[model samples]
Target chain A: MRPTVHHVAEEAGVSLATVDRVLNRRPGVRAKTVTRVNEAIAKLGYVRDISAANLAKQRVYNLVFIIPEGPNSFMLGLESELGQAKLYSALERINLDILKVRAFDSDALANVLDGLDLTQISGVALVATESHRVQGALARLRQANIPVVTLVSDVSAAHRDHYVGIDNVAAGRTAASLMGRFVGHKPGKIALLAGSMLVRDHVERRIGFEQVISAEFPELDCLTVQEGRDDAMVTRSVLADFLGREPGIVGLYSIGAGNRGVIDVLTSKPEYGSIAVVAHELTEHSKRALREGVFDAVINQDAGHEVRSAIRLLKASIDETQVIAKQEIIRIEIYIRDNLP
Target chain B: MRPTVHHVAEEAGVSLATVDRVLNRRPGVRAKTVTRVNEAIAKLGYVRDISAANLAKQRVYNLVFIIPEGPNSFMLGLESELGQAKLYSALERINLDILKVRAFDSDALANVLDGLDLTQISGVALVATESHRVQGALARLRQANIPVVTLVSDVSAAHRDHYVGIDNVAAGRTAASLMGRFVGHKPGKIALLAGSMLVRDHVERRIGFEQVISAEFPELDCLTVQEGRDDAMVTRSVLADFLGREPGIVGLYSIGAGNRGVIDVLTSKPEYGSIAVVAHELTEHSKRALREGVFDAVINQDAGHEVRSAIRLLKASIDETQVIAKQEIIRIEIYIRDNLP
Candidate 1:
């Protein structure tokens, strides 16, 4: 005779939901209760007909990824990975919906978040802009029983279930360390480039970079950061002007997506070959730059990793399952010319 | 009326097995066939209750992890992660069995592989010793339709389905670059330490370290590798002897375990502060060393990541499913004191 879930529940002296949660690997059930349920099943010699059970329930996770619409290679890569994830919907049982909002526009992001029908979307994964409006929207989603996970740049104010990205502060420290090591105690001015101070990631990176550089390489002077809004032309123009003003700058740390601009400026002045340059994101431009010796190192977080991690986290949240923390950590990868891949 | 598997098969002009293959996300079906089947299902408005279907099948994967028994923190970490994975088997439908062979013993590993009951075990993940005997055993497993995935140290000669570890060459190159950059242009000899050259990972790392050091930092002379067999006491004795013999050695690249031994040698001689040290695996000893400024850098591959990856890869192989390549590529992580975990 086939032992049913009811039998196991009765033997375990637990509710049906508890048994189901244990069976489904969902969180919320106590470890002792889970053990009891398993022991009861073992005693009954119960074998789960997983296919029939899943077919009976017809579980499908309706997940949405809110990405900032941009020409940035990193964002594009994220979108591409999401598309790939969507293609595996049959296996994952995920209905992945992608929404693109205005990049860096908090109002636009908030509106999108507020507009989401929680009944329709079981989970939301977004590259959030940290703002009061965004926070309010995320709080609303949480209240409505919808899980929200922040990606790439995290939002502290939001009720986000998890953050699927690297530590920006650590990333910055790594950049500074690389710059210090590459420059080799040579007393020279170091230039810092960023998109803006509005984003938490950029701000944290700036703070971390400053902390490391000031402590370790006091001989080298790190100048004030120049915000180029991550625009290539703006970055190029600003960097060119800065380079002209500070010809003594022997190291450059571009901790943003405006690497093309940095590369353009560096390419125009080939005579500054000795300048040790480190940038963020391994985009096509940066990869090429690393190969050509325009950039000494690129501190990158794989966009694919971020997107997949967000999806996994959101799905786990939806399933009420515990995700392996170590598996979910997006690494701050350092790439040099020799080890590009 | 809902569509059934028969309807899908008829619509796609394929067999029931082909439809099942496509529906199960198995690898054997052609892409065009899968697309046709999927299109047919969509056209017929077919919705599969995947959980119920899987439940009906009652599929359970009996997998094994073959690890080396040692006090080495990295190996212990791997075992711990595997234990965690086993705890989640109720959800993954995996019956995980762990087999610990004698450390670094090719014959012991080969015997274990040869002894596996293919009828009971669906897949195997092993920290393989690269030997002809092991390869032959792996070939037998393949012949019996049992999938094998090599973890940590890989065996290229085996008929293993996949290797779930980072590129050792890239890791060694990264270590060398960090050591070279950290040491600057200071002219001094660098000592290389390893467990054994017999393992593919150590040999590859040695080659990569040598390649980068010779090409980029010709000023720093990297010495021949001293095999310590990964035993702490042996590593300590060998390193102590080497330090005594070459007092001018300014850099140490310990490409294997036995970091504790290295730390012991370094701790005794406080004047070796100028010596740039780079080692692999982030363990308690190494982490403490990094924090104390005794070690400059640690190249680590997450044990949890490796275990989970090996399981995923093996499971996919057992299911004959396609895996996302980018997700499967284990990263070569470079850890400084600033960015630990």
Candidate 2:
């Protein structure tokens, strides 16, 4: 007994073709006609059968996910999740394409973004590299009325419609708090490790970490940040040298990828095992590190959640629908040895 | 063009009626015919247009959410989420009915379960109270081929199709780990609070908490549990009396509700402010306590996530469809001052 398009058309005294145009937001319907149809729909309590409408129209959203190409386990996992989402692409009427650019290369990322054909692409999600060129590309997409969601790392906020990731500042603050508590009152020096200062997430994390350490943990002091560029070998060499030089280091905070290097350094050196370590992201390396007591805590943002949230946001924007705000807030997940999953 | 029902019928060498019967799992179709139809579907890669199929069949799922009625903030939050879900009922074709019974009253819960008209109900979800009477009712529902999902709390494993909540044991273990670390190496007693040992989640949490405390924290001892029945007034009186007598208590683990009372007692008595407190669920009271440094950490299973997961599980069960396992996992979230959200 639910009201349908036919009921709305009958109530509005409009032709079926005009009702279809109004319902689909298609051009050719006059503003007055659209208003009349909408009023009729409201009056009749007509709930559009979205499935049938899509079926008749054969509407398929073509979305692109752009990410850095590298051995970063987190990004790889995200790529896998996107692949899994493709399994439902037929059912959801979505066509997903992934574009990979060199890691941390703003020029490459910008070129890829600028080259995208707006006509072929309905939406875009990217792990943005912060730069004016990239921002300009995002703004162009926005100008073309294409929805854009920034995943993981974000550029200028104004260019993106939504950001599907955790608050990096809060994540860093949480890590600092956990590091402070785990190290206790006898903390001497805390070693800071990051991917790069150029990356906005890393910079934001460093800001928050320094803010907490200086304000709360007066006994502890952070050593100079070592930018490992998220390369495992480079990170391993850098950490080894840093720890060797820093004698009074009582704690370590790995604020980005390259946890493997941190774990390697901690596990190989028995003395450093007692140094309370906090890291970001949950990977095979981090999980093992947590279990073996090398890493005291891990701050994680679920990649699966980010990928799915981006898809949902893009779809909602395309459909002009409201998403559940509470559900979309990606939580900063904290994990220890006891609660791994 | 996407394959239609007519295409499926033609490929299966059957009538459209037979294909419909097979797809909907209705009676009158032979097992051989069902297999043929399924094989044809697979061969043609015919993804079912679930929304269209549901619309065509006018399939409105009638689901019942049976939860304990009380002043418990967590339960109230869950109820509110259910109410929010009602907004999408027409679009999703789900009729959700909430049935509330007295909190912790096994007889009342069992009677309500037994009284449900099975013919009219598509699925059931409940915050279970462990008891033989309730188990029998669940068994009867299973016998009648009804899908049941346990929310927040779970009963015996065999009775429910899915559990849309975090692992209570792991949650308890995580709490103990945090408590032990936060309390440090100082030798003191850790007071344990519970709603009741009759509830399965509470009992399991206690068991896990004890296991970790005994195995790891040799300096700390858990005092006898104090059941407050999750009532603010009763918890206030019990905690006041308990803290007065238990002078050496350095940490408090609240395994269940009544956190408002815990907050009131801790804030009122400045002496108890230094005590490392860990409690379950995130509410206004818990958020305030966390922000004020009255509670060190909060172990939360998001009520919104649990409700959405339960609904998804129920619908998937009704439709005989697969659910994304990762999306359904209710993570044991650890909240601190820095990561309040």
Candidate 3:
């Protein structure tokens, strides 16, 4: 049988109500008292009796995911996954509000965030930028003692509580390893494609890719990266021009979305499909290309996990508990034509 | 702002006590009164404020997951994912008990189910089989009005509340498409290896594979099915023998677990490394093989999602409500070298 609140109270040598206050995060409990209660909790291995604690606290965290207003397949997939996650548990208990804003416009994000009822809003989870207005808003939220979490685009330097996505560097390394091995002992040039170099994920991925490929597979020369801004037209034009210049293009590593654009150009010009191609995000277009042998592998971070993990982290920040990192560390999926899940 | 109990009572033309009784599923409410309350609920769009409702009821659902005891990497991963999920919202309010039993042992499973307390255990979720004893226990639970949800391997014969997992047949078809596309324009033979023919997923996958490959990629000859019984040694030996008999094996599809064994044999043989190897469940071995150019692609199901989904389904089943099938349906994840997320 699990230990009850009464047992914890007795062990802590505190009154039942005082223990309740500490456990429920009620006001007027000193830090010392809270610490003692927590010590008792740890000693007893008392997994928080959430149902009983919730009964007393009735904490319905009003959460908001400030999604970017872009047609980025990954972000769209994230939004859809979040909406679907609502059907998972007692989601009605959550007052979830999705605040969609421009993907790269920090001013727009700050403007919208400033207008929300911060007191009533328990936490905020968003893909953010490192701008003054954003930092100021975060500071304000911190002053108000509200929890803040970042999604795909992390703002951990802002002292955010947790990050709930894949390690972009590891993903990049994995990509390089595949890019090196899959070309089958061929000494040729590999081209890397990215949306933008500014975003931390893309930057980290490129670094990892370069580091691995250079150290292990030196025979393959990695060309300079081309920025497509995740746009199909830009990708198509840029890739077409690059292919024309470099005839020995043996492999392609895409660090971001613009897969549809790449696929269109790859299949249209007969040589691209036969060459080893890799990209990110398993969208409708990517899935099709993977099936039809245009793209070789898709390194993906389960958008659903990211959404759910961000929520959990936000809630944890509000609650101030240590979250296990390994469980939340998202994996990079490797896809070939034969074993696409 | 959402409607309150008072508003619901007013809308239903009932008293506060009656509304409480109906909402709480108390025994005293009349059938006609319940119907009226339900009508009012629908009319007001009174989504039960779940946090507050849980607070008022102080109900802690004791949910159980009866997983089969096998050394399958997939099952271990499922358990690990379960451990991770426990840190989130589910553990706070729900008491989860995982009872590991031997797979394909209907008698033991039925016996175990018989002794359980439905009153205390609000819901039950398991990988069930079609058996008289198991059915009898489920019938008893139904009589007692307990919710029983089926997980990955569901017993459709038993009227369980919900099923929480992926469409294996569709996954198989997707795998087939990938295989057909990746091994394009090459004169090659493929092999379908499975754990057991009796398992629903393996059977369905075989059907789906045959369905797609025959119609789309007629040039690729999918060879006969082989069962490993999910045993490592058996799989390694069987695959090794099969390779001796069949020479032009260009494609390999491992439909189920015991992948380490497959990798061991395949990686040891220099001839097998060049073959397009596709398999299910991403384990340490698979990750290594992909890196070293042994395995090509890995199809995965997020065990965590499936476990969490099962628990939610069980809880919802106890309430006798509709579940969003789209949300519950776990997706098929395709992994390759380039986009390995």
The candidate maximizing TM-score is 2
User: Among these predicted structures, which one has the highest lDDT?
Assistant: 2
The count of residue-pair clashes in candidate 3 stands at 20
**lDDT-better candidate, 2 vs 3:** 2
Q: Which ten contiguous residues of candidate 2 chain A have the minimum total lDDT?
A: A48-57
Error of 2 at B141 (Å): 1.5
- Runs in model 2 with CA error above 4 Å? A13-17, A27-34, B6-18, B25-36
Q: Looking at candidate 3, what is the lDDT of residue A132?
A: 80
User: Which residues of candidate 1, in runs, are more than 4 Å off?
Assistant: A1-4, A12-53, B1-6, B10-53
- Share of reference contacts kept by candidate 2: 0.62
**RMSD value for candidate 1:** 4.4
* Chain B TM-score, one value per candidate, order as shown: 0.89, 0.96, 0.89
Error of 3 at B157 (Å): 6.7
For model 3, how does the per-residue alpha-carbon lDDT over A153-177 read when each residue is reduced to its tens digit?
7775664656666778888887887
TM-score-based ranking: 2, 1, 3
Q: What residue pairs are clashing in model 2?
A: none
Query: Which lDDT value does model 3 have at B166?
Result: 64
TM-score of 2: 0.97
Each model's fnat? Answer: 0.58, 0.62, 0.31
